[model samples]
Target: MTDPVLPDLWLDWCAVTGTPVDRRDEATLGRFVLQAAPSRKLLNTLRLAPLATAPAWPPALRGDATALSQLVHGGTSRINDPDVHWITRLRLRRLVFAAVLLAPANQGGLGLSRIQARGLTPGRLQSLRPVIGRTADEASCPACAVWSWLDVIGTNNDWSQDALRALGHHRDPAGGEVHRHERDDPSHGWLDWPDHPNLLPAIDQWGYLDRYGSLHPSSLSSLVHAIETLADARIAPARPASVEPVSAPPRITAEEEAAILARADELNARVARILKEYS
Candidate 1:
């Protein structure tokens, strides 16, 4: 999954999938990748780039377990339980945001949000299950805990009333409940985001969910960096050094070349036969 291996991985994927390497169609290629069925290997290749960088996949595919773990660490940790954690304010918001954003309804997420979310879910919480790395509160059921926290946050944010109410509560019939740390403070306004369904660009632009949203790249980088730094802490950064230059695509082995040639010849022959039948 390192940078140096990406070229090989891409070449192998294309060969296995019978796709050609076409740099001119990177946008198309990127979309092709997103629409394809999920593969762990495919997932790793996409992570070679920063989530906010050019050629980025949509946020649905990007919220892998590692990213989810980092986003919801406090909730997963017994020692860093939201009740005692110093950064609980920010951590809890990020957890709720990630839950709503990443949990794909069509997937096993039970329609946690109206968005086309993917990745984290109650069943999948087993992946982020806390180890005894810390000692404060006993590790609880992450799935139930997540819903409880969502109910608390949504209630605090008043998501049950007015505009946000139309979107529905984060906790519904499908969601289970657990005891959550009590919070009497005012809402921090994490969802004060733009109306865009895909908040990835908005997050990339405004640098975090806030009242102000702007597209001017320079003004947003610092803010984006700060939030992304926290969220992407566990994510392996892209390695620019190992990336092959644009002109030099990965070299296929002689065996691979022959296989591709043979496949090409087979297709050509099939076409000729069909043409002859028409003729």
Candidate 2:
């Protein structure tokens, strides 16, 4: 099914007011905007011409009410996207490695004592450069370079289909390019890059980070925003009084409880020894 056209009223509200409409106002405003001339003009600009072409609402759509409510209220989490999780994991790994390298030899030795005492071996250090997507040879644009690193860390060592769709592309049935004025000259409009036919899926992957890196405040926030947008657009309209739900607690089975209890006992024993001197 074709994606739902982003409502012009919503877009205008976001642009002019710099805030999402409160739930109380959204439905009423949405209906009114559907019939307004300005809204029609905005829809035309977005090329959503045949308003009647929207797909019949899917039966499974109602099953996603919980997700839609989360999006409208802005209270979802990010672990849902594997790509974002992978990016965060890699970043954490890098941070851990840096910390180990900086730690003093007497404290929790990281096997880096020899390296700290006598400097890093050229070959060993060289191996790390490629892992971080850096070269000793040249300078690159910082933004592009970071995205290149993300490409290596993200899905299948390539771009993700979801990321591509977020940037306005379809896989099976193709879609048109969005063109915009590059300069104010009335004749100098530029189409978005990574054009189709020659488009590489890896290049398409960069679009996700580009569009969402800022929007995703934390990994959890990214998940929440993604779920909300998808749920709202693809599922049902949110209710006027619905507020975003709080995060549900993690589920723990009996075996997990035993593990926690064992860990607590071990910590208690250590604390008891430390407190004996005071007694």
Candidate 3:
């Protein structure tokens, strides 16, 4: 089914991912970009979705027309040997948060209100400096700083693992993954300061954090773009999601799938040029 009416609050998945629409299946609804994921937690008041949030995964990956829900999960969702530089890490971390907002199912919210409640730049870093590590008593650590921001949005940073993986960064040198190992050492949860979990101590493992102070990336700007988009959705409420059904039934046979893709390629055949436009 297509969302005939644009959702009151939806994110442009293709725009954020810089990816263009290639599939034109009956299952889709939005005009150019599709609504892929659902986000109702923390920021439930706002309607936010990624550009590709509603479309199916690239058909190349689902030749058999496998279920997308089964595909999106069960994979590690993490990239291997990622850089540990603070700037790279921070951008990746922010994207991880954004990824959760784009999750396809059983999604949760970040409880993110402070940025909207308070201006994005005001008192944020200072309010954050106090408890950015494993606990309030520890020294300021960038990794923990991420957690503190999450703590503002949700219960703890543990919620970030799925987000991190979905966003494609599993090699967290700062080691936010420590929460996964907590069952083995219950006291790991009790540690109140200084030490957060990591494959190696972030101090010794990541040299970039100490080398750089406040350098930012285009990602931060892109994030601001997303925030502005969501903030506007809250104020204006956009259009209601269309519930009308597509002419095609829920299931399509293999021959039917082939015909659909062929029609799509014939209709939107620019390929490289189109990807460049969207990319």
Candidate 4:
């Protein structure tokens, strides 16, 4: 059965906010925004009312309903993307390395201090692709997606562009080339910079690498946004190019060719006359 309380609460929210009731379903309402701050606004409004608690939703809808409640009533957590153009390869590598270390143990992330002791080595990240992609898909969290992205593209411009295109995210045409140091080697891993600075800790419990740790907020926001966009993306296969047929045209009699040309000329003349009249 459809949960009546959610719709009623949504209606009440709409009435108070004067937002047009576009959708009454639970899922749409979960992501619904009104003037950009409806999540906070609706929650505050509901808090003032005498409602003892949030409505009890079914198993199918409970997840969405709970998420909506957390977003509006509890709080909304915003994770930004990392800026690639301005970011130095060293910092980018550090961020990705830290992410790998900070990934949950359940996801096969190396949360060990001994692994951290070995330092940010390219070898450490070589076998972590499975965990990264797995966590990203199953966690239903933006942080996981960020981890997956860091694993997939890291500091490689080609992979970055390809991944962005796959996710339907736009890369700036005039963003200019990314910084490349002479000794930088991406094949080793995102953390392979030997001479680069070590700014990140071996392990971050607060999920800094996923967020704005040493990186700029806008950059992190951009990376997260791109990964989130990747969720609904459907990459279609490239269409094959059309090839011209090699078969020769059918031979025609001289008289028939002449008649065809005459007919074409007559049609052209008729079109010209019509155009002249219209003009």
Best-fitting candidate, scored by TM-score? 1
Q: Which scores greater on TM-score, model 2 or model 4?
A: 4
| Residue 16 of model 3, lDDT score | 36
Candidate 3: where are CA atoms >4 Å away?
1-79, 82-87, 98-106, 111-221, 224-279
Off by over 4 Å in 1: 1-66, 74-91, 103-142, 154-227, 235-279
Query: Model 2: which residue pairs collide?
Result: 71-228, 76-224, 77-224, 78-220, 78-223
Top candidate when judged by lDDT against the true structure: 1
RMSD (Å) of each candidate, 1 decimal = 23.6, 24.4, 19.4, 22.1
Note the Cα lDDT for every prediction shown: 0.33, 0.28, 0.28, 0.31
Tell me which of candidates 3 and 4 scores higher on lDDT. Answer: 4
Candidate 2 runs further than 4 Å off: 7-9, 18-279
lDDT of predicted model 4: 0.31
Compare candidates 2 and 4 on lDDT and give the better one.
4
The candidates, ranked best first by TM-score, are 1, 3, 4, 2
lDDT tens digits, residue span 76-159, model 3: 111122333332333333433332222222122111222221122213322322221222211112323244223322211233
What is the clash count for each candidate, in the order shown?
2, 5, 17, 11
Give per-residue CA lDDT, model 4, range 1-279, as digits (tens).
221222334433443444333333445455454423456666444444333221221123223322221211110011122232222222323333333343333322332222231233333333333333221222233234333334323423232444433322222121124211111233434432232233232212211222212333333333223222221121211122256356955466667766765654454344223222221
lDDT of 2 by residue, 19-113 (tens): 32222244545554554445456534434333221122222333432322222121111112233333332332222222222222111111122
